[model samples]
Target: MKTLYDVQQLLKKFNIYVYVGKRIWDIEVMALELDHLHQAQLITQDEFIQAKLVLTQQHRIEEQKNNGRDL
Candidate 1:
């Protein structure tokens, strides 16, 4: 089980950016790009895993807030 902190560290380790520009993009886009990179063999499985973890965490947090569970 990887925590958000772990995901952050992994991103830093690979020099991956979560939100570089202010186009208001979500994790799904990032996940898709990462998947494309994986398919192209540009990044390793570990990189993909870390990206997936971070993206999934972001999605979950957004959904929770939208549901008004904890604000």
Candidate 2:
């Protein structure tokens, strides 16, 4: 998917919803859930890869924002 929301929607199809209060934590959990889905062959390899890319980018952005706040 192209955005974090797209990834979330993909997970939602499997009834997976993650909210750990923090954005970074939520993203981390979503990644874990994606891994499980991929392992189970619930999603295609392409979908898995795209979702992961989205999560990684979002995670990096969150990290940068958090780092800026810490500074």
User: Which one is best on TM-score?
Assistant: 2
lDDT of 2 by residue, 1-71 (tens): 79999999999999999999999999999999999999999999999999999999999999999999998
Off by over 4 Å in 1: 1-25, 69-71
Model 2: residues with Cα > 4 Å off, grouped in runs: none
Screening candidate 1 with a backbone cut-off below 3 angstroms (N, C-alpha, C), the clashing residue pairs are none
Total clashing pairs for each candidate: 0, 0
The global Cα lDDT (0 to 1) of model 2 is: 0.97
User: Global lDDT of each model?
Assistant: 0.64, 0.97
By TM-score, how accurate is candidate 2?
0.98
Model 2 CA lDDT for position 43:
100
Instruction: Output the worst ten-in-a-row residue range by lDDT, candidate 1.
Output: 20-29
Candidate 1 per-residue lDDT over residues 1-71, each given as its tens digit: 26545554544555766764522254555666667678878778887787687778777877777679555
